[model samples]
Every structure is written in structure tokens, then in C-alpha cells.
Target: MINEFIKNIKILQQLKDNNVYKKYIEYIRYPYFRNLAPDSKITFDFPVTFLVGKNGSGKSSTLQSLYGCPKGYSLGDYWFTTELDPIKEFDKNRNCFIYGHKNNGSVNEVIKQRIHRDKNPDYWETAKPIKRYGMSNSQRFSPIEKDVVYLDFRTELSAFDKFFHFLKFYSNTHKSKQDFLRFYTNKLKEAFDTNKIISYYTPNRNKPKVILTKAETKIVSEILRKEFESIEIIEHNLFKDWGTSIRLKQKNINYSEAFAGSGETAIVILVHKIFSASNESLILLDEPETSLHSGAQKRLMSFLIKECIKKKHQVVISTHSPFLIENMPNESIKVFSTLNTTGKFVIDNDRNYREAFHELEIENTNKKIILVEDKTAQILIDKTIEKLGKATQDIFVTKYLPGGADDINQRLTTIMEITDDTYVVFDGDQKKLQKPVDLNLMPPNQQDTSKKLKELIKSQTGCDVKFYLNGGDQSKELKEKESLKLAKKYLEFYKRNVFYLPLSIPEDIIWDKKFAKKLLKLMKPEKDFSLIKKTSSNSKELLFNFCIECYGDSDQYESTVLQFVSNWINKEDSNFRIVKDLINKLKN
Candidate 1:
């Protein structure tokens, strides 16, 4: 399943880069919207994009904006000015957004604004382009013509749940309505059990039936990890007014959503809606992870991707689930953050899984912690650990701190104090900090204290503390000794846990002449190898440009390039041995 997911993602990336998804909304820019900065732009480079952030960070708002991008859809449908939450539109802050889509081999922009009129109320309509420098007075285009489906899973409820939980039923005056509900409920159950369709009329003067479908049954079963013989969508007033319930048949037993898990019902509805949508439709999902466990969330994501690719649909999901974003390209994930200065939401484009995890404060449950300098180092260390086999991989979780070597070194003591099982790996360039120090030159009195401290460190941490002394005056010496006394435990802990990569930096390892040639051959065999040497003197920039050139500046470029570097390092090279020894030390 994982391999299939990877393959599908690659296919999606290729399609995106090739511009095969013609109906995709290219990008959306907020000139003025609710709590969003002026001119905040988010590009849609992948068929499926995940909008991730803390609650109220505008993730759902972003989805609503997207929902309004297609023709015949309006953000007003979801968010409109009410007495409690009124949106006052003025000349300066009119609450509008602009989006771009490809038309006739050229990109065209459309502006949608909320217009408050006497009769229309809070209606969203296409407005003339806002004047800007260098803007062309071209003919205006309507919103991209496409089918749009917006599902807010957080608010999705089965008809049975809605009626029984919210509607009036306990009053004696409503006894007849309650009795009718019970009669229809029993009849629906019997129909489900007997594999028959049943119809019922409602006060709305409409008749609806419970119809079974094999395709929906298979998809819902695969996602929810259940074996369903059949699935039915039941629409009847007994369940709720103008709503639907799901019925699942397993083995010889049949159950409505009233008896099934919420996740099962949600998945059935989601699958039905997605499969029923037209090709090249726009699908927006808000918190699809609601009512779903991690495994089900993963399967749901897989199903979504498959459907998107098969139907040429564009999907944008607002979620906080790591499972939904797992295996997705970094370019496909847009993280939202609120600005401290203005308290407005902003979209961050250059982010990956590590940043998302950090921003979301997702806890790592692994037994061991591996801290590194940056994202590249985190990737390298994580991939190397994977090469050490599943046991080693499962035990360790790698995290990269923001600042470079200096910040990590500054926080080493605090980190060690927090977790004894923590290990730190620095880029090979930081090996300069590992210089040896001689404590023999200390005076007899200081030497006596040092000896006691060393033994204390050894006894407590099971590691040797080697003092790296520098030549200085007595005042400096006294200060150094006192500092050592205060931080002796972590210093020894660091000596035991700290290790460095064999290469100076990830760029050097990746752009090594031989390694670069191999990567070029694998990624673009037709390109001349000398082009690498002729590129920028800065290896990092050169590698970045190389990846962009080969991969067409897509979101997967970094991961695609680093994946080769990690794979090469995982081989039986001298660097691999160093990584192996580092892991062995952590294991012991």
C-alpha cells in the first residue's frame, strides 16, 4: 500500500508539472479577507494540497476561499455576515480575494468580493480588477467553470444522529411523529437485512429510497478496514429531513449508521460524494481526519489521491492530521500561521513534514530521540537510520532544531536534562568543536576538584568527562572550573552522545563530484555531467538549481534530490560506517 501511494504521488507530480490538470485554480491571493494579510498568496502546484495549521489559523477559511473559486459556488454559502459575527465592508477593507486560472494557454485572474446590498445581503460576486501598477486592461473572465464539492467533515452527521440528537421527540404532543420514526426505522432495518429497497414520503412532499451500490461498498470497506457485502445510502424523513444515513452489510448482519461507528459512516458518505462528482471537479475537504483513527485517516488519504488522479480532480484539504499529509510532497502542503504583530493569518509555502510537526506540536512517541542541525541533516540521519533496519528505525525519532550548530550547542544541557536517551548529531563541519582539552595543566587544588568531578560524572552518567581547557588567567580558570562544575553532567552526556557526519555538510556530500555524476545519470541521463561543475560555485545553490532543472521546479525537487543523496549514503561507504557506529552507540 505504501509503495502504491508513492507511485501515485509521483504520477500526480508528473501530471502537475506537465500542466495536464487544466481546470486547476493556479493560485489565490488575498488582497483583503478576514484576518489575512493583504496580498497573501498561496499557489496550487499539486493536484492535492494540504492546508495545515493550529485551530483558527485560517485553514478552514482558506478552504472556504477555494470553495468560492469555482463557478456557481460562493464563500457566502459557508461564511456570511450575521448579527453576532458581522462583516462591515468599507472602501479600504472590503473583504475580497483574487485567484488565477489558465485560459487559452495564458493565466487569467478573477476577483471575487463580498457585496452587501439591501436585498442581496452578504453576496459574493465577480468584481472589476483592482487597479495595480503594470496591470493590463484585458477582458475579465468568470470564475473557473468546474464542479465544486465542499465537505466539512467536522460538521457532517448521519441523518439518524441528527434527528435523534437535535430534533424534538420527547414531548407527548409529538407522540405520533415519534411513533412514525420508530416504524420507519424498523422498516428500514428490515429492508437492509433482506437486501431490498424501501421508499418513504416526508412533509417536504418528496419520496426517497435506500439504494445499495457495490462500488461505494468496496471503497468504504477498504478505507474503514471492514469487509462489507454491500452499502446503502438511505434518504428518508424518519432518519432526518433532507439528509441521508448509511447502512452497511457485513457477513449476514446489517446495521444503519445509528449502530455503526462514526468513522464508518463518514467514510461511506465521503466515498459516495467523491465517486459521484464529475471529472475535473474541485473538491475541498475540511478536517477529514475528524472521527477517524490514524490508520483510517491514512487509508482515506490514499483513497482521495487515487480518486483525484483517476478523475482528474483537484483536491484541497484543511487538516491537522499528519496521517493525511504523510507521503505527500512538501510542495503540496501549505502551512498557515498567524502573525504576532498583526494577528493575521499568513501562508508559509516552503515547509516540509518537520516544520508541520513542529508547528502542530505533534508529539513523537518513539523511545529514542535524534536531534540534528537542520532539515537536511534530519533527512540524512533519518534515512541512515532506516538503513539500520526497522528495529533501529522504529526506536528512534529524529528532530531538527531551528538554529544552526551554535543554537543546538547552547541548548544541549537543557535537552540532556529533559531526556537521557537523547542523542545529537552535528554536520561534519562542526567537528571542529570536538577538539580535545588537557586538564593536566590545572593547579593541584583545581586538579583535585576536577578529579572528584570527573569521578562524579562517570558514576552518575556512565560516561567520561574530558575537560577541554584553554590557556587563560586565574579569573578565567576559576570561571571555567565553576561552569564545569555546574554543567558536568550534560558535558559528559554530550561526550557520550554527540556525533558528527563524515562529510562537512549535506551539500558537500550530495554534490561530491562522483555522487553528483551518479545522481545526474539517474535523474537525467541525457544531460552532460560537466554541467554540474560549470554551475554555481556554491554547492547548495547548484544542487537546488540542478533539481529544479531536472524536476521543473516542483515541490518534490528537494526530496527527490535528497532521496538520491540519502540512498547513496546508505550504501556500504565509509560514511555509512560512521553513521552505523553512531546508531550502535545510541543502541548500546
Candidate 2:
């Protein structure tokens, strides 16, 4: 079955890419001022746009506004219109296609309409039978030169001697047919008290082949005389007339009356319509999901997508089903709806997903480690470090797991268990945020750290919280007189926000020089904190950074002496033992 579908589409549209170029012609969207919008609305990122608005919100009206009701322009073949360009807006028009509606419009539906309308050009051209209570039966083809084989039921005609034509033609305009009503369509009942060949699919090794009975083959070869010298049908039976009624060749097929039901008839006609226009038409389908099960709907959509691509036809479908769009690319999908009385925001991205939440964990480490919050930041870290002449691999950087602050502590445990070198840098209150609680974490007095630290403030007008990106714990240089400024502009354009709105994170990451210095200060233990005796760590850069951070201003001479003395002690490896041995020998 799959192979047959593929082959059918393959032969029909194998013009390479060139064949599809002809189809690139987009049906005109006549730009006109819609009262729905005060100004011209522009949209993008999707090749097809389906309008969906509440009734009277101009969904149908918008479609009408785009399409011209040319006598020939119709949404379907079932309408009649004689209104001549009610508005003369087409003098400057180049290319446009607007068809009548009322009858469902699809490739199949459009093809049949085109065929019926083709022969009735004279009647449709002048009277526009689409809604004119079109005359049926006994109406000869105008010009009387071409042949038309009308296959309509006998019930549509009311009188004898008046020819019987298309179905349900009771008026100059449509008088709805009871047979094709929706209730009758879902019986799961076959329409025919009829005899016909049953076509079935079979496999030849791996390829697909159509199988048919002899009678069915005969009918197909007879009707299809153009291409095959010998034709094969895909069904297994043939219709036979028995005493003024039709019956199937298979047993248990005798119908008391022998006429096919309208449901089956509709399916036949619809299929014919699609097959005919499969080569050329921009088929639009609305609510095909009606009367279809979820599985059927999926199968139908799959068939349609394959056919459109293979036949190189353009198709636009409107659906609210998320399942239908899961297979489509994000940019190819556009959501059209109004969020306000005045404007509609168009979402061109179809693949947008909510960001998973996670925060970073910071802990003491023997080695230096850098951590970032998200993918964007992760990318920036790698790229920025590369730009700064540092190899990414040289700087062990990782992202924290997503979630709230608790996730940060959870992640820290995981990382600390694996490596000794790690550092976490992010944002919090500008007053110098600390772990577990930010700088905003205050005593019950609410006197605020900034208020008490005023003795260290040069500018106290900074924001409540700001982002601080600090590293190299050696720079404990907080100005005794400064306060952080709050900024709201940075968080507004995260680029991942669902509606591009700012997220309400506690204290949007704030920054200040003191924020960097505070980490260095915190590294020092209390006076009771034990210092390493004979520390032999090879990473001198980190140790120096720590010393500068803790005692940056303490005894400049002592600081210089500490570094030289540490170097001299490391150099004494064997020399110290040798000096001790020499002293003993001299004593002896």
C-alpha cells in the first residue's frame, strides 16, 4: 500500500524540482485594510497561514476579503452568484484565485467543480449556477459540440420529460439534499445493494501489486483506454445489472432494491475530485477531523502530506490538534489569534518549548571550576573563554541541573563527590549575596545590610538586587562607599520566554565589585580555623588568589616574605636533610 502510494505520487510529480516551480504560485492574498485591524498586518515564518477567530471576529470575512467573488470565483460548485465586482479593487491586480464556497473545497472537490463548470461555462458564466437555483436535466451543453456524461440519481428530477442531471437540483439556488447529510455518513454502512469488483493489495516479494478479478480488470481496461494497451484494475469484482437492478457477483449480495446510498456516492465523487486535481491545485481542507477517529485522522493527514509533497501540490490545513502539528517543523507553523481588541500577535515559531528549570550548586573545591546556569550561558562561557585566549577544556565548566535553589545544593553534592575543583558564580542581591540565602536575607529588624554597612557606602542608591558575575576570589576590593543599581531591561529579552515576557525570579541577578570581593573574604575561616601545616599544593595561582583575597592589605612585606619563604621550603627537599647531617658530623 505504501509503495503504491509512493509510485502513484512519483509518476505524477517527478519533474524534479522544476515541476514544483509552477506550483510556487501562491494564491493571492489581496492586501486590503481590514476593519479587524486598524493598520495593515504583516506576518511571517510560515508559508501557509490559517485564520481562526471567533464568529464575527472576521474569520470568514477575512477569507472573503482576500478572494474575489468573480462569477467563476467560488468556494465550491454548489453556489450561485451574479454580483459583478461589488467593489472595483482589481484594476491593479496581477494574479489571484478565489473560488466559491458552500460546498467543501479540496483538490477532489475542486476538480469535479472544474469539470462540471467547464461544460456549463455559458450557464455558469452568465447565470452563475453556483447559487442560481441552477437548471438540471435536459440542459444540453451550450455550443452543443462537447460531450458530457452526467451520472446523477433519478430522484433529483421532479418531472418526466425534463432531463435528470446533477443531484438535488431542486432550485435555482441550493435546496439541501437529505442524502448527503452528516448523520447518514457515519453508519459505517456500505451504500450499494450492489455488485462490484473488490480491489485489494498484495505484496510481490517486497514491492506492492494491485490484485483484481477478471470482471474488474475488464471494466477498468474498458474505461481507461488512454495509457494501457492492457490495463489492470486493483479491485476483485464487477458490477452487473440484474432485472433492472444492480447486484454484486459475490454471494449474500442481493439487495432487495439495488441502488447505492448517498454516502458511498459521495465518497466516489470525492475521490474522483482529489485524483483529478492531484496534479495541480492548492487544496484547502477545513475540519477534516469531523467524523474521523484519531487513528483515521492521523492516517488521513499522513496520506495528504505524502500526496502533497509527491505530487508537488500546495496544501493548507487548519487544525487545533497538537498531534497534527507534531510532525511539522516549528517555523512552518504559525498561530493566528488576537490577544487584544486591537492587535494579534503571531507566533511564527512552532517548535518552542518551555525551558526546564535548574540552578547551579556552589561548594568549596581544591581546584578551580566554573559553572553556568543555562545552555545559552554555557555556550557563552565556552565561546567567551575561547575568545579570551583560554581553551574551553582547560577551564572545567559545567551547567547546573534545572529546578529551584534546592536543585543547586543537590547538584553540588553530585559534583563534589566527583571532583575537588569547582566554583559557582551567579547573581543575587547587590549587597553581596551568600549561599542558601541572598544578601536580601536579613535580620528581623529589616534594618538591611546596606543600612548598617552605610559606613562602607559611597553611593547608596543602587538597586535592591543585581547580577554579579565574579571570578578569581583574589579581588576582595569592595569600595567602602557604594550601592548596586537595579536594572529591569536585561531580563525582558530572554528569547525563550513563551510570550516574550519577563520571568519573576527572586532578585534578578544584580552586580557590584563588592560581590566579587565577598567570596574571597568568605573563604577565610574563623581565627580558630586550622591552616595547613607544610601545605604542598602545586596550584600556586589559586593559593595566591586566596591569600590576596583574605589578607590583600595585610603586611605587604609579610605577604612578599610568605611567597619567597614558601618557595624556599619547597626547594629544601633533600638539601634540608643534608644540612642536618653536615651539622651532626661537625659536632662529632
Candidate 3:
């Protein structure tokens, strides 16, 4: 399968001082190669995979990278590819092809390229070793494997015409013509339930020369009729150098190729190729979204996906169409884009997942908006707001906009214009919290909050607070002293609250397990409070589920903390509180 075959993509950058033009030795950068993080692993795990992104985001480059593997476009050649060699690896079966960009435009280009290719090349004059250097002229050709079918949205009816007529001329030597007819008829019968062919001859001609069999003429008519219901195939010439010139009868008027709509012609040829194709071949599609209407795109993708599932064929697409990407699995969607403030190619899986959810309208939204980095921050903030019972009109009626941290910050002005009450929040990624619960700052009544939280932890796991903070005593260290193990258990307790409260972790967090794991390692020994806190100018909300879960009456502690933060912001303290500036401006 194409998905299993293409295992990974590693982006390389051109060396600063290089002897070779296309020689790429250095990696772009980890966590970000260009628009995507270099360490990101893009896997083809579905029968149909899609490459989607804004123009110049490397969607086209990534598509071309896969299609022109080993050598093709330069890493720096792309608009978004300042320095990135997007390399793709295939499994044992390196079977795939690339069909270039397609739409109303590409059908012309496809024909032009084929028509312009050098049919014959010069032979080597002397039997000497030939040296080929520099990046070769960009040619889009896939492996010559039986399991490959490179199809663009540029299926010309003339090509199909030439193919069918060529078969008729040399019908004796090849059995493939019969196979094509059988395949076409089988699919047609399945769709229309008719074994009889429909043929038409021009009525004006005293004796219309019928150079083809009735079945052959009828087959052409029937094939086109499916796409153009209003038109019927009237006549066809088989022996002409132009191959087949089909005349159509529409509403008592005769029409030929010149008179037919581009859309209708396209669909007829496209449908023919699809139904007649062999099973299990990788079908590469470019911009089907641009060529077909919304309804046609939907119907075609649905049909092709189902066909892939049944026949074990694979399909890959490069498109800017949301209609196409939204229907595909998140894992199957490869997004190409430039990261913020950095001119680098980013193969973003998390943002791609957002595209998928957005297509289904599954992204959570409320009447009011609270812009947060991701779902995890959204859940924590929503839950914390509820716990605090702030009674502000915003908390009861706000929805979270899960744009990432950088996006929210970049678009803060625009978001504020939408609603003055909009607040930005993020996970505790700004800086490490040391002894998060400041004992000196705690009010007299709330002094026992930390002790009580510790007691709750001991009750749940039968481990003392010191055990978690100090990695246990020397004797108990051997039994269970690992900070990660303790953090996992603690995280589990808090994570349970998230589910019970009915909140799901965002894919961004899930995809990067190392980040979360390392976070826990950093915080486990720091005596950080489990409670959520608004930490930075970015509205970074650092909260562990264990902290939220430990409090018996989370409301009081939450209210107290909220009041303290509000007081600090009201003071407009410039000494230490970084978030004070943003909150104070909002308050005014």
C-alpha cells in the first residue's frame, strides 16, 4: 500500500558552502524545518492521503517532493522553502506517481508537456563515461510499476479518443483492448444495468460510413451519456487521424468537441479513465477540487475512497481545497506551511488536525470567546472559571478559540476587536514554577490548602507529600523513587478530573508526549501546586489535573486565587508579575 510504503519525511537544508548545487547536508532545524518541525514524522496511514495548506506553505512542494523523490525541485527553490530538502522514504514497494496541479488550467498544461517531450534522444557518440551534474530539469514521472497510475484533473477526451481508435487499428496483436472493454462494460453494467450498446449515425448522410462495429460506436455514446444526460452521442469517425470525432445531439441540435463545455468534456474523459483503470494502482490526483464543483468533488472523493477500500488501491492528493482535506483523516492530512516569524517549511500535523476538526465543525465555540493555545488550556480555563464562580458575564457565556499560543498573540488585536472580554491563556510553558504554592502569601484561612491537598494525595496513593517532593527516603527510594512514576500517578489523578468534567486533551499535547513527560519531570520535584495559574503576559495557564483534583472544595481555593490575582493586577505591579500589565489594561 502507498501509505505503508512512504514511511517518513526528513527535511534537509542546503549547506552554506557547498560544491554541489543540490547537495543538502545540514538539517533545517529540529521542531521546525521550514513550516513544519524537522523532527515531525509524517506517515501515510490511510488508503487516501491528502496534502493541504495555504499557497506557498509547501503543500505543493511537499507533493512535488514525494513525486520527485531522490532528485527534483531544490529545497530552496520553493517560495516557502528558504532552506529545506523535504526527503520522502518508501517501504519495500516504492510504487507511486505524481500528477501535477490540475484544474481548468492543467488539462492544457498536461497535454502541452506530453506534446513537447523529446520523443527521441541522441545516442552517446563515444563510449566514454558521462558526467551528469547539477539539479536536472524538473520532470514529473513516477516509477514504471504496474501498481502506479499518475492522473491529473487534465484528462483530455482526445487522448481517450486516440487510445480507443489505436486499439481498433491494431486490434489483432493485443488482447488489452478486450480487457478495457470488459472493464468499462462491467462498471457500466453495475451502474446502469444495461448490456446492450447505444450507437448513432448522422441522419443527413445518404449512407453514413460506419467504420466501427455497432458495439464500439454504442460504447462511446453510452460512456459519454452518463456524464452529459442532456446530450446523446450522434456519430463518431474511427479511422480519422484525429482518432474519434464525436458528435452529440442535444435538444435536437448537433454539437461537437468545440461546442461542448469544458466541464462536461472533462467529466466524460475522467469517468472513462476511472472506471477502466486496473485495481490496486496508486492514483495521484492534483487539485480535483479546482476542476470539479463542490458536489462533484464530494461524490468523486466518496467513490474513490470506497473503491480504494474495496480494491486495496491507494490515492494521494495535493489540494488547497478544504472540501477535500476536511473529509480525510487527520493522520492522512499533511499540512505544509511557514511557521510564524521564521521563514521555514513546517510540516504541521497539529494544525492539520485542526483543519480536519474544523471541516466537521467540531471545533468548540461559544457566544463569547476566550482565545487559548489549544484544547488543554481551554479545558483548564473553563473548569477553573466555573470553580471560581466569578459571576462575570464572560465566564458563563464564552467559547474557547483554540488557536495556538503564537497565533493568539499575533492576532490578539483582531480578537480584541471582536470582543473586549476576550482573554488569552496557555499551558504553563513560560517558565518553571518553584514551590508554586507560596506559603507566606496564603491567607490565614487558606493556609491549610496545601496541607489538605497533600493529605488528599496521600489518601489516594498512600504516599506522603515528602515522598513526591523529595523522591522518598533512602529506604523507600529503591521501592519507588522515580519522579516520572510519581508524576504519572499524580497526573492520572488530575487527568481523571478532566474526563469526569468531560474535557478532552488536544492532539497537540497527545502528539508530543515527550514535552508533557519532560514537563512532569521538571515539576515533580519543584513542589509546584497542582492548581491552575495564569502565569505570563501570554496568559499562560499552568495547571495539573492532580492539583485541581486534590481540593475537597475547589471553589473556595479557586475564588481565593482569582481574587489574589485580580488584586495584584489592580495594583499594576511592574516589579515581578508579568501578566499584570495585560490584565491591568483589560481592567481599565
Residue-wise lDDT of candidate 2 within 110-217, one digit each (tens)? 111211244453122212222212223222212111111112222221111121223233433334433322222121112221222222232211112123344333
lDDT of 3 at 69: 25
Candidate 1 vs 3: which has more lDDT: 1
- Which of the two candidates, 2 or 3, achieves a greater lDDT against the reference? 3
lDDT score, candidate 2: 0.30
Per-model TM against the reference? 0.61, 0.29, 0.33
- Report, for every candidate in turn, its global Cα lDDT versus the true structure: 0.73, 0.30, 0.37
lDDT of 1 by residue, 33-60 (tens): 8888778889988889888887889988
- Provide the global lDDT of candidate 1 against the true structure: 0.73
Best by lDDT: 1
RMSD in Å for model 3 = 25.1
* Model 2 residue-pair collision total: 47
In order, how many clashes per candidate?
Answer: 1, 47, 16
Error of 3 at 517 (Å): 52
Task: Supply the global lDDT for candidate 3.
Answer: 0.37
- Give model 3's TM-score versus the native structure: 0.33
Per-residue error for 21 in candidate 1, Å, reads: 1.0
Q: Residue 582 of candidate 3: its Cα lDDT?
A: 27
Task: Name the top TM-score candidate.
Answer: 1
